[model samples]
Target: MTLQLLNRATALWRAFIVLALLAGTSIEAVTQDNRPLLVAARKKRTQTKKSRATPPKKKEKAPEKAPEKPLEEKAVDLTELDQHGTNTSESYNRLHATQPSSTPNFRTYFDLAFSYRPGDQPVSFENFHSAFLLEYTPMAGLTFMVGLAPPTVLPLYYELDWQITDRLSLRLGRIWIPFDQINPHNTFGGFINTSLLRAASQEAFLPDVWADLGAAAKYDIIRDNDLQVESHVYVVNGFGQGGTDPKGESSSYPDFSLPVARQDNNDDKSIGLRVHGLYRNTVGLGLSFFTGGYNNQGTTNARITMLGADFQAYIAALTFRAGYAYMAVDLPLGTSRQFYTRGGLYTELTLRATDKWKLGILGGVQQNDNNVSDQNDRTIWGGKIEYLINHMMIVSLQYFKDLRQAPGKTNFDVALLRYSLTL
Candidate 1:
């Protein structure tokens, strides 16, 4: 009976195992039939879960607003009057011309100088000055200038300037010839020494070609922050057959004429060249050259050639200046008989003590084979003190000793005091 029971149990277990295997085969077959669909559903569910897990994207920011308009230009006061002689009615005209202005402007400039001399020649107070300078500018590159002074009651200088380019210009009419820095009317100082500058440079072997009917060409060879070079060339009516200007007394080699004659005295016209340079504007140098003809009582073929050099330098409160000139002048006795190289040299030092005061020392010599009629020699030593009363006015006291060694004249001394104003 036990054997029969054990066999029955074994059969029951075998039957159970077979049933489980059949169920497994049926499930596997179903899965194989829907394989593609199951995979797609699983992937779709995974994508939906990922989408729900992430945060939302932010919106884009707006752009900023633009500005309304550009700013307006500043207005100028046209009705304002200037008390300082430096700025006259014409100052505006000059300023306007440098800009783009539609209308022309007119202005006036005034300058005055007075001198007092005491000696056996008698004490005298004389006003030697440049006053009533009128200027007009119609365009950016063009200007017309006219000036009037005493004695002649005529326009001292009248010129038309046309700036052809930034570095070139053309000038016409009576213009100032730049031979020396000392007497160019630049108004560098108040007191002008009659001995040092007048007899040395002003009435030098070369005549003061202050104003002459001519045309000039100017160019800036170099212009920059640290260095600059400028040049000028002029062609004009040269000297005449030097006779007394009806006022009597003519003092020149063959007489470099101060031609008031409207026409040329001879066929030859004079030519002049000047080159100036500046290093940082604290130091300066200039070279001058002139070649021309002179006639004596219509006796043609007389000529004059001149060369000059000048230098200036500034160090702290002190300024130094120097100049030298050599001229080959012809004094026609007959034919091309002879010529002489005569010259002048000068040196000056100035100390600026304060805003209102200045002190200076100057020395010079002029040696000529013939100044008046024979060889002339001169030595000058001078000192000056100046006080600035205002921006437009200055007062100066200067003392000088002029030692002369001439053919037949005794040595003399000259002292002068000057009061000057610029308007």
Candidate 2:
């Protein structure tokens, strides 16, 4: 009975194993039939778990940048006014300290001077006055200028300038005569006192201020970095013979008070020329010539001729200037006019003692005429000390001694205190 029970139990166990194997095979077949769906479901669950585990990696921000600064302009080399006084607009503005203006393309300047001379004779305000100048530029290469001096009847200068080319210019109206260095810089107290040549010529021979109504042309023959050559040519109404005018002016015989006349006194006109050269701003030279008929009568043929030469040099802190002038006038002798000649020369030296101080000395000699035996000849010795208060203001003390050649004539001495201001 025990053996029969064991065999039945073993058979039943075998049947159970076979049945489990068959069940496993059927489930695997069912999974294979839905393989795509099961695979997708497994992937989705894996991705969800991964997203929850990692917090989406906080986005990394770019590094902060610093603020930028403004760009700086490069340095530039500036050139000064050339020999023709042709300055660029920017340079002109810098040189003049140009002020703001409401009017378009206009500029104005004021110059004032005061002088006190302790002497027998002082200069008349009419002869030397302050100035106010105005300039108008309507277009490129064209300009108009007017300058007025107080206590004077007429304008000091009024002109129109046209720059035809880079090196050529034309000017018309009452203009400063382009003769010597002094006329170009004629403001009282602005420069050292007038040289002997200028004073003698202006008082006895040439027109005051060397000014006249004229048309002028300036040509820059050569201009470069450090060298310049310029030429000026002009035609003007010649000086009038004294006592012949309706204005009640008397004749100064043996001397010429050649005043600049508004109208021509004679049919003939005057002609003048000047040539100048500069080297490295250290050396300068000039030559001038003028010729004109002074006789108001159309029949009388009397004329005047002038020749001039000037030089300037700079060395260390010293500046030197020298000028020479020769003048000849024709005088009526019986029937034919005779030519009498006069000549003069001056030399000046200035020392820049300090930024605000300057010391200067000048010496000059003049011959009135060769016919006279040392009668009217003269010598001048002068010294000056100046203090510059600012770029546009100055004060100076000047002393001058005059030695005359005439017998028994006393040597004259004078001292001056001068002040100048520009606006």
Reference-based TM-score of each model = 0.66, 0.65
- Lowest lDDT 10-mer window, candidate 1? 79-88
Deviation (Å) of 169 in candidate 1: 0.8
The residue ranges of model 1 lying beyond 4 angstroms of the native Cα positions read: 1-120, 185-209, 243-253, 257-263, 296-298, 333-337, 368-376, 407-411
What is the lDDT for 412 in model 1? 46
Best by lDDT: 2
lDDT of 1 at 253: 43
Q: Write the per-residue lDDT of candidate 1 for residues 311-400, one digit (tens) a residue.
A: 888899998887777778665554233666667777778887977788888777775554343224567677878777766566777776
**What RMSD, rounded to one decimal, does every model reach?**
14.1, 13.1
Local distance difference test values of all predictions, in order: 0.60, 0.61
Q: Could you tell me the lDDT of residue 306 within candidate 1?
A: 80
